[model samples]
Target: MERRTAEDRGTGTDGDTAAAPLPGRAAVVIVGGGVLGASVAFHLAEAGVRGVLLLERDTPAAGSSGKPVGGVRAQFSDPLNIRIGRRSLEAWRAFGERPGADIGFAQVGYLFLLGDATERALFEEGVAAQNALGVPSRIIGPAEAAALCPYLDPDSIVAAAHCPTDGYALPREAVAGYLRAAARHGAAIRTHCPVTAIDIRDGALDAVRTPHGTVRTTTVICCAGAWSAEVGAMAGVRLPVTPLRRQIAFTGPLDTPPPRIPFTLDFASTAYFHNDGAGGLLLGMSDPRQQPGFGREFSREWLAPFREAAGRRAPALATLPVSHGWAGLYETTPDHNALIGEAADVPRFLYATGFSGHGFLQAPAVGELIRDLYLGREPFLDIGPLAASRFDGPAGEGNAGHTGARPEAHII
Candidate 1:
């Protein structure tokens, strides 16, 4: 993959240039330049912590962060997820008003369509859970849902969970904003620098070895996204994240685009689509047949299934022409949730990965959470439920029990 920095994308900088010389040592070494890593660096610097080094093999947002559909929402099945989503949404809203960041965030809303009784029940439960966390999400009947998003085929959906505060943002902008801010706050970002190994001494993190040089740091955080497992292995800690290929297609400009609608999802099929801010529509769906790997090549085979599913849920887009398509990896876990906090077995080694497909949306809250964990401060939200220690059984006997974790149905 080609290495491109935020400067290449023309995102304003906070005065410090990126791709600086790899230093011999630092207080903390963040191995990854995606949004999550950048967020951690930015928050740490903002909190008065200095000498932080952020390394990226490619560039900021070059991984999953760059390819995401950029949906931000607070409607989640779990209470922790809902709380994190709410906090993340608040940060997204404040980005534009803050220094060096305007993520082009829009609150067009999100609507998950429920087709059957079981789907309706699950969605209702999810909505109640979200509401209890102060998220303004509700289960609306088909008619109300259709009123909110007229493009949806009401007959195909029995009920829908709608959250008006949920929407999308520009991932690249967010990454660039964080990098620039981190740089200004005395953090160094190095692109095209990959950590080859994690040095551990006496069961404690010693340093990070890279091609350029070895960074002697006691604290290391892995935000490598899909490649987290490989990075963790260098430190003798096994991560359960698997890289799953996800594809998305964009429609050509429409003569008459549908009214500004929420990011719509067919909960049963996981088929989803939303406006691209341009006149076109962005659409995608998970391929059940897709095997976990690093394959990021787009496939024509997925187009037909996505179209068919979209047509059934949103008849208005049945015949829309797909002008272009792209593929990205989703660092999925057994529970379809993120693994946050310090690794129980690896002292001085922290983690903020395994977000399944929700990393980009949750990066803001995650950045803060990781900063809190690293600094030994009270985190804004209790992240015990997301610890990597949850899968301590047969499934994790060899690879840290990541395979034993349960699957989350609310994915997508």
Candidate 2:
């Protein structure tokens, strides 16, 4: 895999030509050039939203989307996530063929193991929901699970859910493909132009103020991901999005790597490891009490959980030293779900943030949903539970004893 560094791309200063007003105007303005923003730009342009302008504080794919573990799976506990993942997988399949870059999309399948009866029940419910949505997921016995992944210890797994359609996609390649295709379709995407503030009056968005200059557009879509709260605050809306740091590590290449298989998540151990498609392993796990910030600074200490979990699940990695690591943030919400759809007050302003840790794999479906919103059409999947207004008024259920979306103790 090609690692993207700061030196390879411009520092988002390429288009900073004086703080002059932008010429004419765009029908839609998208903030943040990461996967979510790029997908929206591409889809908006495809939906006939001409002169769509996308602004990024840095170069494209320089945020969480660039540094994510690039694992795609439809094996989610929530029905909405399953729908989104399925749609995204469909788009990825087509995207792999007609692309400027070959996004390494592989449907090696996913193995979500269960440790106890309660966990097995949850997995079964999730698998049923997936089946109802036309997703190809099923509950498999321990024997079947071991058959699918020979290295797995059947004795450790109480039950398992397997989804052959669950897969992975190279992040940068997907972003580049969408950007190039969107550019060809007539969208003007600009990087390094950070939107400093948003102009709002009467609870409606007027325009966006960026470092370069003010860009006037009738509609604005906020896809800032980890920095979504900052953009929402510009319009006087206290979005519930919060940034939480996460870390991932890579192992040295193995002489005889395990056979290619889909990503596996050991729920009991809170462990996840997958083949890097090059004889190495890519792994990650979440810290129960991780700090909330945008800075990439991380400690080597975060590797403890991953190392322990890997050793417990796959002892072969006991001697493998961590080659390198990457740090990123998860834009979280009160429900641990995304904040999609238009805000109740900010009429022309739409958002797609708070994806938790599933942004990279879910980008394709998110783009299509945003496109539907812009075209005055209903989203392919219901987005009612993710609106910004769901957090409004007296703070209702949230402040009055309702527990927020706590991360699963097992899987981060």
Candidate 3:
């Protein structure tokens, strides 16, 4: 990919000119210009912090932030996730109303179809957990699920969990909004400026080395998404994040598109489909055999399984011609959850990566949590459950008690 700055695309914010050069230092340097990093920068600047520099190896939303199907929801098996989802939903709604940064956020809701007794039980537990956290999600019968999403095959679904306030937002637009807001608040965003190394002295952050120049800063936040592990290594922190490839296919404009349904998912097979909002359907399924790597090439072999799953769950979409599709990486951790906090060993080196597939939807709340951590204030949300220390131990030996069932069960 060609490296280009925000100025090259004429997207530079106020006070940023096309001919401006990168500064030698800043109070805080954020690596990665995706939604997560952009949100952090925006929140920090909005909190009265000055001289904030956000560096992107490529343009904003060039990673998973730009590639997801854009599903947002508050339904989760974990309370932390549910709380974060609730706050993010609020932030998305506020962003949609903000002038000059209207992210097209739609509360189309999310429907998780349960196919069997075990799945139904799990969803019931999830709904209870979500409701306890103030999320208005509940278990609905197959009839109600099918009525809400007419294309679904009621015979195949036993039960489902629905949350009307959950929905989708344009990831690119969210990133743009955050970037513009951050820059307008005196945050300098430098795209295409990748960090080569992080300088550490006496177990503390010293500076950040980049191709453009060395930035002497005491704080650095790694929001590099899939590349977070590599970025963490520079600071001598072993981040347990690996990039998993995921693909999505878009069907051609249908003669009769399905109803404007919620983002529907089959909990058993991890198969999901939703309206693309442009008279087409977007579909994807997790490949059980997919290995961890940076490879994002779309595979023709997976199409057969995708069709089979989609056909079994929503028969009407089985025959639709796939018009186009793309692939992106998911920054997955061992438990398929995010690692968010400052490193215990590496001073001033904070991280917010490893969301598996839900990072974009959770970025808004994470930005505020990170800002709180940096400012030494109590965060609005409890982020202790997502600390990096949870994985601390000998390198090869697994942490037994910590290794439990994955918290985020609805990965699709």
Candidate 4:
């Protein structure tokens, strides 16, 4: 294998991109090249951590990280996650200074549409948490919501929450930025290197075996997205992550582009749409009947339910002709939250996965958190609650340990 200080710079999602001669040894080995892996490697290498090697099964971002566009927001129901979102947004806004890449970040804002009093109340409470953390998000009436996004019907939504600072950025560019920076800092990134096995001895990680070759190391970081469970299993750790297919479609370019609107979502139906940055719109929704698996083939059949939800929420979008689509996997857990913590049984084996669909948005912060872990420093915040060991207890008891799990309410 060749040493890849550069090349293979896709966001750490599906796979593809790089490889040079493989090193026989490394101080650390990162599995998965998705945005999380790239972010983590960048942080570690930037901090002067030596012998860093990031291996990908395919081109970085080839997985879910390679989405057409990724949402970034600080809108969360819990303070802990809100803090994570806030810090990440700051990093994204200043990405050019740190990773030095134009990620095409836009702060058009995020609008969450509430269709009923129950959802309205929940968002009202969430907005308070967000405001306390310095996020300028507010709950607005249907009239104000329709004003912000003219495509919405004031009669359809009872209430809405808008955060003027939240928006999205290019995922593939973000991944390349992080990995390219990591390379400059003396980190080695190799592509086409699927981790076949992890060697453990006496409860400590000894080495990582891949299709290319085995590299001896005491530290291993698992940033694998949908395949995180398989990576965790190689280390005898139980990461209860399941893969689910999420699809999105783009309308053909129009004669008149829709006005640039906040990334909007109909919270009640989980339907959402945003400006494609082209003369079109991007549309998607969660198919309640979607089976949990690694099947990411874009099936137009799912669009039927998406359009049905749009009919009730945004009538105009219901009849919009979709030009093309893409499908990706979401590494979901029982709680639909992320799993970020080191394994208790496996020494120095760290993992930050099961992000469900927030991996790209949370990559920067997760990278910092894992870097702190490898350095034995306290993280910026307590992530102990997101430990996989939480599953050690009975079902629904995932929030019983460490700092205790906070409520994860916002969904799109």
Task: Give TM-scores for every candidate, taking all chains together and pairing residue i with residue i.
Answer: 0.92, 0.89, 0.93, 0.94
Better of 2 and 3 by lDDT: 3
State the lDDT of candidate 2 residue by residue for 53-158, as single tens digits. 8777777888888888887876676667777888888888888554345888888888887878988987787778788989888988888887877657777768
Candidate 2: where is the Cα deviation over 4 Å? 1-24, 97-101, 393-412
Report the C-alpha lDDT of model 1 over 347-409, residue by residue, as the tens digit: 878899998898888989998999999889998888887777776676643242232223443
lDDT of each: 0.83, 0.75, 0.83, 0.86
Which is the better candidate, 3 or 4, if ranked by TM-score?
A: 4
Give the candidate order by descending TM-score: 4, 3, 1, 2
Lowest summed lDDT over 10 consecutive residues: which window, candidate 3? Answer: 396-405
Ranking by lDDT: 4, 3, 1, 2
Best by TM-score: 4
| Residue range with the least summed lDDT across 10 consecutive positions in model 1 | 8-17
Model 2 poorest ten-residue lDDT run: 8-17
Measured on C-alpha atoms, candidate 4 has an lDDT of 0.86
TM-score of candidate 1 relative to the true fold: 0.92
Which scores higher on TM-score, 2 or 4? 4
Best by lDDT: 4
| lDDT score, candidate 3, position 372 | 97
TM-score of 3: 0.93
